[model samples]
Target chain A: MDERVLLTGAEGRVGRAVLGGIGDAYEWRLFDRDPPAEEHDHEFVVADVTDDEAVRDAMADVDVVVHLAGDPRPEAPWNSVLTNNIDGTQTVYEAAVETGVETVVFASSNHAVGHYETERKPDLYRTDDDYRLDGTELPRPSNLYGVSKAAGETLGRYYHDEHDLSVACVRIGNLTKGHPPIDYERGQAMWLSYRDCAHLFERCIEADYGYEIVYGISDNDRKYYSLERAKDVLGYDPQDNSAEYTMAGEPKSDV
Target chain B: MDERVLLTGAEGRVGRAVLGGIGDAYEWRLFDRDPPAEEHDHEFVVADVTDDEAVRDAMADVDVVVHLAGDPRPEAPWNSVLTNNIDGTQTVYEAAVETGVETVVFASSNHAVGHYETERKPDLYRTDDDYRLDGTELPRPSNLYGVSKAAGETLGRYYHDEHDLSVACVRIGNLTKGHPPIDYERGQAMWLSYRDCAHLFERCIEADYGYEIVYGISDNDRKYYSLERAKDVLGYDPQDNSAEYTMAGEPKSDV
Candidate 1:
């Protein structure tokens, strides 16, 4: 597999996590709607995912794509979500196919299956509720943004099935640095440490699949989401856990 | 509950089956993208599913919506499927949510779960595979059009869970009038009799559920999909069977 990758939305929080670790490992070509403050190791193209021409230009000679460019707000409105997420994702997928890119690691969110939370929340974080969220479960997105994310995952599937391209959808959880927020049980259960985030995405680039949906978070003891698929498919082995930061009943640190 | 319903795509082949018998009972506000040649008892709106304002206007005071709009061709291109199936569906669902409609009997197709056929296809049609396609199984759509339909189902789920809007997705089988098509064993086993189509939709109007996914075909002796859920949930008691038209081992009719 070629190490030459074009990472869109490379200036965002998840983007930084990826670049901070894998900067020297691969031949990087980053694209962002906004240019980052600090310079990168390789070429950085400032462009919008909605702009097809710009995406096409940035996509030239790229072996793989990590497409994360779009609106990420949970409560994003219809019009904004339409252009930023749905239309923009279509543009990217089309561009990837047009450019003959091998693989795409799409950043799908937990909200793609968020409605499960209404019934499986607090207990999923506690020592009870043996119930777990598997990748096989049908998506029940919570908001328009979640709908848009789900749309992205479906786009990946279409491209893969129709065009023979490989794709992986990472249903990412709450990402935090050093420690998870205090009293936020849900976030703690789903926390993806910065180190683990980078490694999980690295697996996205390395692994092989026709089309897959895997959870991207540290292997927390409180999690209801099964990491078996990720481990078996992507060779993922998460390191960090939210249990280290919390005391007996609550969090010890106040961030 | 009111026996009256507003059904879109009421002139198509599948629509004809659902409309032929139910026409005698419900006070329907029938609609079709294409204007039908014959006169009807209920109001018909000859407009596109993308037309949000027109749909919402028609949805006023209606208790249920049996939406079957959009291009149903399984091999449609990306743009065609994206706009007609995905975008049109989003518009309709948005309108349904806006109008405070109680239930939506969405015409989801068997192709939405067609990927499972890879392991058990022509053989499964001849003899039961001990495996049956259920509503709860993960969506493994075989084509882009199927992917679009799955997306529509997910959208229904979101609306139902988030806004208390009830939705029922019917993964319809090979719908034919008199008998199954020639050289099409898959169609024969999965044939949905015309009378049963009307019967199933009528059940949709009567059944009570927050969210459901049920097969929309007759109870055939030569079948793969289990009808337990449809029977239990929608009270779907199909009157016609494919075996009645065709004799054992000897060929008869291809409707």
Candidate 2:
């Protein structure tokens, strides 16, 4: 798609992943508190998402937004999450509405429903176990950071309902470059490879919806997050499966 | 209950209603931006809910908090609702969590599910119709104000799940002093009287719940909001009925 897209938190991992995968696909306006590490062809705006004027300015002529800016700490204090994640998200949404932007692809996390993992452990993580969490479950955040993410998702819902903005909240699983977290079964079960992350977000940018939430994970055989909605709605076809890679993150070439 | 409770928005209509109905039932610390219009026996603190230090200080040793501070206008813009209602509620919740408080009684509004009314309209407002919203359905906010209240409820859910704090969100209906809105069938269907409003909140403070949502309208014959959850969970047995009052709000002594 050649629509003008605004990618917030361009310096972060998720933002960089989107840029690395499809940076040239769209006319880009990258916004972040810090500049990117390497030079890029897209226009960059060095401003916090909480800065209303700068955000509104950067939002001009943007059609879609991939919002990933926030405190990414699971143990972050209430104050930090409240201001940086919750309020910053609100600013992004309000500015997006003001600028007549069409869609916002929010970076929600697995932590929004992390309690399910704690509640249904060992058996739930087993390879044969089939209990799955679709995107429709009520948010059960495991920490204050998770709470902030839940709040952001709810904010997207509100903005969509009240302003008629298309919002796609991606409850992303464990994302790592090249492979899953080494020797961690839980991580492998929810592992989302970098290419899969990029593809999922690309689907989010291209998808047409009112307000929707979908899991952002690869086609892993042991995954507990159901990607049916993502496939049905956004036509997301993830490429890599964590099962093909060993716990040490090496590809099973013999298979 | 004789526990020391902190009542934010002590100067508002809901606060005044609670104070009028149950003034001597509990020890209270009243907080508001403006001092009460008249004198009172309870200790009062003048501060905005957004002021973090002041809110935290007011929360000391408080057993329960009745948070009512917000911009109440249904047509309120994003900035006012986001700051005054959403952020303010977050501050109250964070302070409650920090101060080791047991519970928070949030004052949500009927607007949280206002779309049902818009959709059902005259048929639903009829005295014979029995369609009801039982607080189990997903929030369908009709305005930005409603969106703010929904955000507050979600925040409560997160705080409850993460911090082990008990929270009760009361989706209050049309609250009138003596009777329902004049000559308005919709208002009559969702009216919450002063005494009933106070008793509902009293139940909110004393009841045991992990995270719950209950309708706050009195037991009206034409009601569309179900009170079963309130009765079963919080022991809310409202005494007043809007059907017992005339369009002019006078008591129907000879029904």
Candidate 3:
């Protein structure tokens, strides 16, 4: 728990969730394109992920990198995603290997396999459906952004195979604070509570794996992404479930 | 086969194979970064695939595009692959969508899933070992070049899903002219004959598929990469088999 973890994109939603839940768990070096509003405990570095020198400098003495920095937009332009997501991820991997970083927990998105939802839409999102997409399936991206995420995952695979870098790509689901998404069946099925998100990423850092691709969702009842890999490989024991929340995003009574 | 086909990277090896075999079949618009040394039977245009305007211009009135343009080297650097392979592919997809091109036969390499051979080594290259990697398997790239190819495949997936354009990725094996590779079991296992390579690309242009990833190897007996998808989907009837050749790369005699 005392490993000096370099958390890129430290100001983003996923970054905030990881820090908010497990801020005290690790010796942190936070990196982001933007400066922190107010500094507190961890060392903060304001630099773009695509900046090779800055990323290498940030990786100095860092054991693990929770690489979450990138263009996160689903509809992001090709130029933006290519530069920020694909290129930036490459920079991180190159830096990590050069500076002797042990592991990289890449924040891959559900969009990497987003087209899997195309054929099996409303039914796949329902609790009655038995179909699921584990992490082993080929990427069928639905957008340029998704393509970028898939590219990032492939980059991780390459780095691991070539340089023996321990890499784990968390194909993260719909992470929402407090409750699941309101009235959205797909969102509900793929919902990841903030606490579970933090826990999943925590396991990713702590786990000893050569390379892995795992779904980063809570134990949702109406789910298509299998959490078996995450549970078995990363020892990720998620405590939250989307089924605990009503369709209206309200907490259901335990009665 | 009289469709106005735009052939990118017309100067490369695969382009030569296709044109050499099926030169007179299609009304061709040849495109390459380098100008043809001699006069071609078809119209040729010199332009980079990364140039969006140039690609679109080349796509004008094109019914099919045999996109073979990129850094072909397996050891190509990150910047080269990023720009030539990934960015160039996006540009092709964009141009194809914009200019109403019907089909794209992408020259994807076996390197896209090269790491699959890592654990299974020389055994998987033998005829007795039935371990096969069908098209449905996820990418396990071993190098940066492989990563870029996988990224291109993902980009094709995105374009097919979003724009309804037909895309077929031919994960081509080691394409050698006349005979199998000399004393390389891995190469012999996945060896693609020049004639078979041409026919495969022809099938890619002719047959109908929404989006597909097919092994472009010949009917090699010592193969781990399956050609069933290609045969079933694209009606790819390959003629040559590497098993007909000796380990020293000589064609076996029929007693």
TM-score-based ranking, best first?
Answer: 3, 1, 2
Residue A212, candidate 1: alpha-carbon lDDT: 92
Badly placed stretches (over 4 Å) of model 2 are B115-131, B243-255
- The sequence of per-residue lDDT tens digits that candidate 1 reaches over residues A148-207 is 888788778767766778999999999877777568888878889899999999998998
Give the DockQ ranking, best first: 3, 1, 2
Residues A155-237, model 2: lDDT tens digits: 78778877889999999888889888887777887888888888888899997788888999888888999999999999999
| All models, RMSD in angstroms | 3.2, 2.6, 1.2
Q: Rank all candidate structures by their lDDT, best first, as comma-separated numbers.
A: 3, 2, 1
Winning candidate number (TM-score): 3
Q: Over the full model, what C-alpha lDDT does candidate 2 score relative to the true structure?
A: 0.88
* lDDT (0 to 1) per candidate: 0.83, 0.88, 0.93
Candidate 1 Cα outliers beyond 4 Å, as residue runs:
A51-57, A247-255, B247-255
Q: Model 3: per-residue lDDT, tens digit, B198-249?
A: 8998888899899999999999999998888999999999999998987666
Q: DockQ for candidate 2, please give it.
A: 0.43
